[model samples]
Target chain A: MEWQNELTRLVKTSYPIVQAPMLGVTTPAMVAAISNAGGLGSLPVGGLSPDQTRSLILQTKALTTKPFAVNLFAHQNSPVNTAQADQMLQFLKKLCAQHQINYPKPDLNSIIFHSYEEQIDILLEENIPVVSFTFGILNKEVIHAFKEKGTVLIGTATYLAEATLLEQNGIDCITAQGMEAGGHRGTFLDSKTLPLIGSFSLIPLVAENCQVPVLAAGGIYNGKTIKAAFTLGAKGVQLGSAFISSNESLAIESYKKSIHDAAETDSVLTKTFSGRWARGIQNKFMMEVENSGLAIPDYPIQNALTTPLRVLAQKQNNKDFTTLWAGQSASKAESKPAGEIFQKLIKETESLP
Target chain B: MEWQNELTRLVKTSYPIVQAPMLGVTTPAMVAAISNAGGLGSLPVGGLSPDQTRSLILQTKALTTKPFAVNLFAHQNSPVNTAQADQMLQFLKKLCAQHQINYPKPDLNSIIFHSYEEQIDILLEENIPVVSFTFGILNKEVIHAFKEKGTVLIGTATYLAEATLLEQNGIDCITAQGMEAGGHRGTFLDSKTLPLIGSFSLIPLVAENCQVPVLAAGGIYNGKTIKAAFTLGAKGVQLGSAFISSNESLAIESYKKSIHDAAETDSVLTKTFSGRWARGIQNKFMMEVENSGLAIPDYPIQNALTTPLRVLAQKQNNKDFTTLWAGQSASKAESKPAGEIFQKLIKETESLP
Candidate 1:
């Protein structure tokens, strides 16, 4: 089987498999391990500050000379609505009290949200070879700057319109994120009604229309699924949940165990944790918030408000309060080293016709 | 490629493809055409009267000597609530008046709700060789009767639990109906929150756990998707939207045209038409009902109220009022004869590795 395709050549990797860049779960060591093992590894800086992003990139660079990608969150910030924020704070307080947990008072004024624009200088300064973004597309100036630096730009799209828009705006590649994908959706066109097109339908449609190569993401955890993506016209495949249980992943033990014990139907799309919709295991916090019928504040704000609860949950090893982010096929995830997982994907794919 | 798998052998078809039995779209001519072309054609009797079902079976048998299957609606009938029905009637009348269409007066008492149990005697009398059902599993007596007649039984499942239930209840085969599937969801375990697992994730999970042969359904149109389904642990593939544009389909010209122009993101799941959630093109009727926020009466009652509107819409060639049921990949459907579609599928699969 021929493995040298446009995607592999563009990423400069031995294979087309990509380790998805998941915030909070991805570590510099995991990214370096995958890149060193001949597949493209992505380091996520979506929630990190400029200094933290630079340090992680440097750490990954020191660990491996192989090319890896850096990821950014390109969502536009919504203006803070004080009334809604206060209501959410009250709701969280009452809920935390019920769970016999301490509620940390969140200062909305003190929360500093980093925009993708602020991270552009760091990427240029670090001389990053590849950059991928989710939640939305980057502005023309940012895209131009990346292209001027000869950086490969990969945009995440959950709809056909978004995919075409990415191509028209000079994006080198598009990652077709399906509904089964873990983490926040990359839908920018119509966020109110999230387009939940699956990979089985999304890949062929995007690949057929877009001039650039399309990488299939969401629910892809093994070689058979990777092969299936290729057969459905995807140039490559990106996997996130498959690495959730990996030894190098920063995910806590309880979070990893929850994924291991989950079934295909266990995960659901919810906006209770963050204003942006994301797939995760159904836990008590999510259910309680959803059943309360309170409107969640927009992204950054809600994410900031829930930080203390999640951190405490992690410290106490309570899986209920933390976001158990995973894809629909999280049950297939195995606890192993990142390099071994990458090698097993290659072996499984090669063994098939 | 060897097409002689357990699925093919059980259905006695040359290829491992099944033409989905879509109510109101599948006709005797279409069923015979697909069966004659070496694929299993399924005739839908879910909405037909016993005599009509018998007549359709005889007509299909006369057209083709090859084996085919008969589909039934195994959903339990919900009791009709008069107040709810009256409210639905008033809503439909207002909608019809706004569209300048005459609203046919529907008599609730005159509406005959047929059960799967009622259709069993018809199937037995007609000596149907193969049987398939959607929405829920059958009782033990029904299964025993089919087994005694040597009829091949196939059950539709939208979740892993449903698939396992079907297997445990003596179902010979299971069709893993993904979220991308057209028409009504076959979910029975917990219908309140529909399971939206994609085929990429659903197929492997169900196949890995169930002892029966699994068939992948939803978003499957061309040879590449068919090949992808097989790679994802599906023994065979069942296609619904692909045959929507066939010459023998009973769908109105306007409905067919809607599917021909639909994109992967055009279709959405809504329960406005039948109380049971179904995927269809976004149109005026679906939008109006959904936006109205009226509580739709359950299956038979809602279906009855909408029947007159759908029929009149078809007569007047109004695409907005009729149900344009289609899968996510309706855009990939080609207008052709049913037999030609089947032949093209075989040729395309054989040409691929």
Candidate 2:
């Protein structure tokens, strides 16, 4: 199977597949394993402090000298809305009681976030080869600074407008995030519009409209999906949910097991978990919190508030309370070494008729 | 390009493309024109009286001796809620006043609809060779009756479960309607869930999981999209918006003009026009109605109530008031003979790398 020249040249990988930088799930070892296996492996440093980000980058570098990317959340912290947060907290408390677990009030005032500026400084110091961003776009100065150092920039877009904007901003690559993709939607423009586009629709539009190299992301898995992405004019493919259940992914065993056993219909998009709409396996927390009609805080705040429940659920192995972040194609995912999954993906892509 | 065996055999068409039976648009000439071009042409007979249905079927038969499919809306009528309908009517009245047009009260009690059973009876009596349906599924008895007459059955599904249900009931083919498609969602299940799956994601899932042959729909217009669909495991493709601007289509000049002038980001899903979620180019009606937050009556009722405004809008060449139902790729649609469009699509699909 022939591959797009731009992606191969830009990422300098043997294959066009990318192991997605899943927050809280992908580790340095997993990233290195994939990078060493001929695919670009990404480190998601969205919630990490500057020191931790530096340490992980060094750790990944130490593990593999191959080129890899570091991903960051480019979003500005949303203003804290106490009333809305409290109502959602009340709803969560009820669910916790039902599950026989204690719900602690989140430290709203002490809520801290990783500023992209600090992360960029660390990336610049380390001379990171590739940097990818989600949630929002980075400012012009930061993007310019990274480019001056010969760092490749990749941005995520859920719509054609975002892809066009990213292209206009001189980004090196764009990942078209279809609605079928799990985790937070990479919609940088109007989040209120809600992501209604599928990868099939978004990929072609972005490819046709944008001049930059395009990476198809979302529900893509296996050889057929890779072929479909290329057919849609995407240069490469980035996958998150497919790796969530991988042996190398950092998700809890129960979370991985849930993804393995999930049906295609088991996933749904809900903002109850993180205030930003995300696709994941439907759990009691999602259904009940969503049905409650209670106002929820914005991202980072809602995400931070739910951290306790997620941690407790993991410890107890109560799958009902855990957020099994997965995509519509989660059922198709298999738990295996990241290297094996990467090799299989490449083999399957090459074997397509 | 080689096509799937089951689809080519089932439709008896040289090419693996289906011209979607768009409501109140596709004409007998268009249907016959497509059928004569070696592609399946479908007649949208939904909401018509039994006599009208028979007449249209006869009209199409006279135009094309080749096999074509008769399509119906197999949905149960939503119960009338007078309170909600009244509130929406008032909202419409105010909008009409703002537009300097008089609004008349609809005959609420007399709002009647054509049942699918009667439509099926007409189709069977006419000995239609092939039949397709959207909005909902047909009952076992109706399906059995149609099959007894050697009629081929096609059903629409937005989700995998819907496709499975259709397959279990002995559907001959399934059209996977991704979220990017224009017009009313073919979703028969909870419309409240909102169709979130895209064609790229939905087609593969449905194709991989369901037993019946799959036809990819939504956002497909050009040869590249057709190639992408096939690569994702679709046996054929069903196109609606692509033909909306065709010279053979029955859409008004202004409506067709709007589609021609559309951009990649011009369309949005709104419930204002039909009280059912539908994707179309945004206009004053959509913006105002949505912003009004006024309760709208169930479909058919709302569809009937808004007819006069659409008629006036077309007469005035004001595209804002008309329902320009189009898929996300409507901007790529061309105004040409249906035969020419079908031939081009076939050529493009054949020429794909």
Candidate 3:
């Protein structure tokens, strides 16, 4: 049925929402819970290998025969110097010593790039109904590949210009991320030039300019904000931080409790965690990163350099070394079952006039 | 002849603008310039006695008989405690020694506040049409006295609750002072609960509930922000900090330059100069205020205490010590004739659709 607002109608869903494919946070079970509840679920395959990405897609389908999207970090790995990577690894080794754990050698597996071409082949064969890319534009070849298979192409942008670029490339929908959203700022088109586009300002701007529908992302957790986004002309709202503590997600219980306790003041943009600006709860790890006068290596290498620290920190409850990625709407993250959260969010959205 | 549907029309100006009645900065000449330019010009008579207030008003009337408002501090009198005032005087006496001049005694003039009630009485007898009060709210008794005389009473509120309270008390209009505004915060309700209401969020919230016309009074200087404020539901826009450099203002050249050179990141809210929080271009005075562990007294007492330091700092060309008050829109403050500034603002406001 061609409805007035087909995003709400075209996607058969209990709610006009997408469970954001938050890499390292979005699990197979998390995708299942949101999809099974009749909303589109997204599995983040951004930081994973081809085998891992294939397993997640297959496992998500295993749990729910319902439609789901596979997300990829389409951003290029920035050039990392061999000498700089060693210094970053050395700093990590000292942190590993704090936990009395043996330092592991940096291997090719850590810096390995999973081709979007290969990931596309898997999704195409697996018949994934949706595919989303973040951090950069999906090239014409890859976008065309997905379109040939009837897959919905959702390209993410952190600014209006990127969204314009996405629409220019025949992308289906655009996601305008405000500064408050946590994790890697999927913005590379001169973050300095973009007006600190708060959701209140950015959504109206993008919606007014773009021909394709814009899905508002960043800081939308409560039903009030969700309704406000829709009122600003968003067809659908994609949520990331709100799903951090869901029962189906893989975060530690303390992480969930931390999000619950955080207020609007708790989040700040710092390059301390992963060398890229992301919003998260101000933690001891963030403090240490600030204090350690080190020129942070590039993203994926920096991502690998801090892996041991994050893993050990999460396991030992030493929050100082943990890579705690959270969005501006961290306070709205729930530890309840995803189904209840979805129902409640939809109910709240409907409640707002 | 009363205009409805917009806060601007209620203001009854050819151009929907108000000349910021800056306390020390604005002179009769500047007020007349804005008035002559088809905008409402204003001067702070709070610093003057009833006789002096009448003289200034008449002086401005000689320049232009058009509508102009007399702004008054709404408190009872200067809150300067004798002991604290003595201590501040002693500190200034030492600086006076360095300057080879005798330290002036607490000017009885500075201590003498023409109470809003007393000021309104003067204005009423003089047949003044508009009166605006800041620093606090004028009493309902006084508000009624002016309203009976067909005078418009404008109250300054730093938060939503204060705005609601102002309207409840029959205030004819309100100045929505956001966190970006310079000068003493209008702590009509409570000092500690002073809200840093940014203009983007504040104007609409106040306008949505306010029956009286809403005037957005914060970091607004240029046409873009003026248009934004109107679009956000303001009737008239007020510019205090932006007027610091006008030909009729009292600021030193360096003081005006400080504002002109400021970036959006340059402003900081500090309780350094006066005890109450005020945003300004951060300087050495701000550094001292940040470092000083002294518990500043309330309102005019703290204002009186710092008067010596500010005055001395300006005379000695020591930019560090002066209480250089400005808002987040300091970058837009320009050195020009008052008429040109008013004309520019009005032209910009009219340019908006």
Which prediction has the highest lDDT against the true structure?
Answer: 1
List runs of model 2 lying over 4 Å from the truth.
Answer: A82-98, B190-192
Order by lDDT, highest first: 1, 2, 3
Candidate 1 per-residue lDDT, tens place, A170-247, comes to 999999998889888888887335799988999999998998999999989887999999999999899999999999
* Cα lDDT over the full model 1: 0.90
TM-score of each: 0.98, 0.95, 0.60
Cα lDDT tens digits, model 2, B312-336, are 7767777778888988788788889
Best prediction by TM-score: 1
Give lDDT tens digits, candidate 3, residues A1-353.
11137565555555668888877677899899999887889898986777988888888888998887788888777777778778767766775677576666567345675656667778888988878888787777888888898888888876567888998898888888765576777776664233234554456567778988888887677665665566566788888888888888777766777778764445666676666677677786676556777777777677777776677667766555675677645766777888778878877766644
Deviation from native of the Cα of residue B80 in model 3, angstroms: 22
- Between candidates 2 and 3, name the one with more favorable DockQ: 2
Tens digit per residue, CA lDDT, model 1, B1-353: 78889999998899889999999899999999999999999999986688888889999999999999999988888889999898889999998998899999798889999888888998988888899999888888999999999999999999898998999999999999999989888888873357999998999888889988999999898889999999999999999999989999988888888898887777988888888889999899999998988899988679889999999998988999989999998877778999999899888988997
Estimate, for each residue in A67-115, the C-alpha lDDT of model 2 and write its tens digit.
Answer: 9999999989877888887777777888788878987767767778768
Separate DockQ for every predicted complex: 0.75, 0.56, 0.07
- Higher-ranked by lDDT: 1 or 2: 1
